[model samples]
Target: MACMPDSMRARYDVVIVGAGHNGLTAAAYAARGGRSVLVLERADHVGGAAVSARPFAGVDARLSRYSYLVSLMPRQVVEELRLPITLKRRRYSSYTPVADGGLLVDTQDDAATRASFRRLTGSEADFEAWGRFYAMTAEVARRLAPTLTEPLLPRSAVRDLVIGAVGEVAWRSLFEEPLGEVLRRTFADDVVRGVAATDGLIGTFADVDEPSLRQNRCFLYHVIGNGTGDWDVPVGGMGAVSGALHDAAVAAGASIVTSATVTSVDPGASGVEVAWTDAAGRTRGVTAGHLLAGCAPAELERLLGGDDAARPGGEAPASYPEGAQLKVNMLLTRLPRLRDDVDPVAAFSGTLHVNESLTQLQDAHAQAAAGRIPDLPPSEIYCHTLSDRTILGPSFARTEAQTITLFGLHMPTRLFRADPDGSRERALRATLASLNSVLAEPIEDVLALDAHGAPCLEVRTPVDLEGDVGLPGGHIFHRDLSWPFAESDDAAGRWGVETEHPRVLLAGAGARRGGGVSGIPGRAAAMVVLGSAAG
Candidate 1:
């Protein structure tokens, strides 16, 4: 059971919907600015998709159930909010196994990485090309990352910044060409191409040559994080990240109401009226000067009477946004041995690419788009315990038990819509098989059992995300990611969080430059209300 705030009032200076990390960020900033703020969440707790849980009955290991990894969150937000959070950098970057050996990217040791590349590719060409390509991206990331925290710049301004930082060729390759085309042109080896292309297709369901440039947008976000593009694992799982934000918001005097389902939102001349059904089934309404929707654009549309034309991006398209990935969480008794000589700690510490070669990824996407699960689903595996063992309980922490999270590409909601249970089971089997292909033994051999003697493994498909997290069609970015720069001249200088309504703003992943676990949109929205462009 949940209860409304003890000091609930009839009105607030600002009202934010959804108590996810973004909503909590807005509440903290708005409240710290001496404004009365209220945050309403439909779930009983905070941290929407970015949460930690002990799914297995009687298990003490806490896993980042969804939205694992921290990137794109600006250091400014962390410093300003005084968040007690630590992000650990993994020593090894990634390891993609091949038939003979494997390509291991050891960030701490370039010589070892070069040797691994030479052993796998039989030359130094791809390794040198890799260095040059990322070097170009590093310059671009350094120049463009800061702009994400600022007001939207015109397309030309951002382009000029990239062109100045890197060169015309770098700009054209990253911004103008399809990411697939760029990858194919940059690398000669298929495995190398796949490794680079995976960044572009993380949560996106598109081929390298998809004309829409969706992969390009996804690739851009992946590389521009904190000017380094290195994805860090949050200490103590993702729940800690949300927990810190929740505490900050509460300390700043924001009123948070949980299990409060917002029913209606009416924006008018005076202010915005928001009505919700509380945990007690009692309807409550409040008015605020502004409403920050920290939810999907589609959910916002539904609250406003299902008007498709009123969405943030204008009229609804033929279909809503759909998330195209499968997330699997597992607890293992001990790390599995690899077929290659590389240590398990090195391979699983970072990203373990399984059957994600460029050609295989393209084939998988085509198969999924054609309404069948890919026979060999491409997936990446990560071991949280290798980077940070704090997520495990004391007893488990002292042992060899570990947490493995597998993210599969191209498992869209459409594949599971017809028969969710059937498709999920199928997808899960296919994904595990794909992973097993590169392992010394079946992964099932090392899976730890819960108290009930059941394997401690759980899977979440896009359809599952839609039901559990309120993501429309389970689209992870809330919608297709927009270019960081303004799409049109008129939109320049705006926060990129402005929606169709004057008094409402998008404070979620749907906002421009909004995606992943970054609280960027929430921070930007608060800046808009505070009349500060450079907050």
Candidate 2:
């Protein structure tokens, strides 16, 4: 237990559990609203998953360590917080390699994209269908994205909003049916179907036709980012995004304490008493009128002296969250040559799908579910340096050094739970092999060496994420993503960040409209607290 700071007050208007981006966002808003706020973070620094690191010793590159790319963060939050953040849109949407050539969707050149589609599929029909499918999603994004920052709409109302604009069939395809089924019915090309389906399976470990429709939920969040679903690269890497939020929170008079690990949470009638250990090995306690949980629901439950199943109606407690992906970060001396003769720059700029065709993806999912690593792992890679060179040091900024992030799907926690290190090694080998299958030269040829003479590459498995960042089961979304709309009448018109307790609210990815890098949950929680204060 940490001893309380002598100069600090014993209580505050609000106390946040973690100093991640969402926690910072909530603290900024709460403090700005004239409420005394204190943010406790276990880490020595802020920014949980949304951070950049120079993993390789003496490497000149600062790579986005976890949760690369940004889309769901709203401009309203940025403007309101006055955060110093810059996001650059990607020109190429994605490029998938086929046996002969490849399919490259260039946002800047429609003709080139169409020609690339034709070159692969031998027609423009797939491209037209791609346009139509995205057009429908675009409409849904336009209508639904704005509602994220507002109160939760009833499921019926949100359905009407979507079905009215996009037609019932489109609505059913997106919200009701399995994303894999929808992709199969919408796109003819296997590569095209794979490209669309990849979004749904991003950190979610589920087949396209997963009966629970988890894939659909994941897909909905992916495409609804501020109405465009364009994943942008943060200028200074993910660290810049969290750094801005931290600065804004501090500027708003929020007291942020790092290396303060919360030990217990005592929620009662008057207020919640939080016990934590400070950096100096002393325990401290603070009382708050309201508590915002920026940690995972499971973590909050644990702090409340409960297990996963303790909170029955709050968050579904039947199954624990399980992350399904392999994250590999690499600093490359130069981009490797592609087999299809496309410029390595163009191919790696956007998402480079490697062995991720629809059939391949489905097969990989099947193998992984059967307790075996995919023979040919389905993965995607994007070069961060192409979009933002500021992440590199001055010496490497003008050189060919680049940062590559590869996210391999279908590698669930179960595969590594028994043998974390061995399984991770096997998964990394399989993932690199998958990427090499599409490249003219092996990726190893371009590997950058750290100052210690080791390869400048780091691999994080699901287990690694849990140990490294306290992600329960390493689930990136904290848990499975929920539909944005209110599921019942009781939830209608309420802020989706509410918990079973009156004084506690969720301010992380576990809240409704909370997944991804968006701070909607943080804003919603603050609004609820402010509304209660005003009342």
Candidate 3:
């Protein structure tokens, strides 16, 4: 624990703990609304999992270790914030390599994509049907984006009525319907169906063919932006996006303190007392009218003294069943060689879903659910070098290309017996071996692999237990996206940000609408406070 500065004793309107993207956004909005705000971060850096790290000595590159892609971010936030777009922004184009040496690529251009699908399935009608299904699903995704990003409390009379009407109209047709059936109705081609189902299965413990899994369609709202159908990478790296947000927050009159770990939060009647430690060995406390937590709900619970200290749950927190994600980042001296028919550039530009059949994906999920690492996991690889040549020197002379490989539905972090030290190395080796099998030459010599298991991730980014990079369930969309809103405390949207605890509001990803870099929760919290004062 470090000491606080002698001059840092002023009382503020709000105190925010954690400087992740969502936290930063919240701070920015709170400050803009005429409230003095302070942001505390445990790590020396503030990006959380959205950071750029130098994997190899003297090599400067950005890598999104836990979260590798961004499409779910709202376009409104990007425009209002005027975020920089230097990174190689590409759509979420995906390629699934078949065991028979064939490839299926999903593209935004419906006709061209249909042509490709027909080539793979040998049926034009099937291909066209797949296109229509995606188009329709995308429409649903667009409609659902608002509900996810903003707080949807139906507790108020008018709000409840409005919500009821919307729910009746939007979900009446799809309610209780299985996601696979929805896909089946949308696309006749198995390849098309597999791609749509893949989106629902990844990052979740749900089966692709399960009933009512169609709720996952809201996650696809990333497609709402640009309608281009590709997941874009930030220029320079994922860190650039967070870096920009941090700068924006600072510019908006918010002060950020890095390497500051908040140990306890005592919620008083009117304000909250926050105890934190800085880099140097010292203890300090700060009082604020409102306290917004951007860390995990569990971490917050622990900080507030566990269940005994927590206010009774208004509703049960959404169930984010324990699951694990294994990420392997590799620095290769030479570009990986693919089959003659595959374009290395296109393969690396967007996300590549390997072993991408419905059965393969489901089996991996099953293995993960059962607390076992799949022998052949379904992996998604993004080759940064192919898409952004700057990652490598103009001619690849001394430059090293980076690849981010994600292995989902594998080894549950809670069930794994070995320490992360050994587990990470083993996972990296396994991933490299798999890549080696597909490459023309041995890649062992050029491989500079950095593997992250549960422990490493917990240390680097503690928000995974909360289930998301946005701290407390990487669900950037937050409570708004949780299903069956009627049964959860999240449905009330009375997230304490605007209640009688006027001085204290919940601003982090754990608040009202929940996570993401959108900064909506932060802005909303500020608005609530400001509007109350005005009234």
Q: CA lDDT of each candidate?
A: 0.89, 0.89, 0.56
| Runs with alpha carbons beyond 4 Å of true place in candidate 2 | 1-8, 308-318
Write one digit per residue (lDDT tens) for candidate 3, span 1-535: 1223335566777788777777777766667677777888887787766666655444444455555666655666667667774545664377665544444454656666666666677777766665555565455555545654444545343234433545542242244466666666666656556666766544444666555453353334334443343466666666777788787777777778888878888887666888998779577788877777766555566677765322221222445323344555666655566653666666656766665566666676687577555656666677665555544434342454555545444344443333445654555555555555555565565555434321111122112323334333333233323341323455455433443344556665455444334455555566565555421
lDDT for each residue of candidate 1 in 491-520, tens digit (9 for 90 to 100): 999999998788889899999999999899
- Candidate 2 lDDT, tens digit per residue, 1-535? 1112335688888999988889989988998998888899998889989989989999878899988999999999999999889999999999888789999899999999999989988899999999999999999999999999899899999999999998998789988898887888888889889989999999999989988999999999999998999999999999999999988888888888889999899889889999999889888899989999999988898898987443322333547788898999999889888878888788888999988889999999999999999999999887899999999999899889899999999999889988888999999998998888888899999999999999988999988998788788888999999999999999999989888899999999899887888888888999999988631
- TM-scores, all candidates, are 0.97, 0.97, 0.80
Candidate 1 total steric clashes: 1
Model 3 worst lDDT window (10 residues) = 453-462
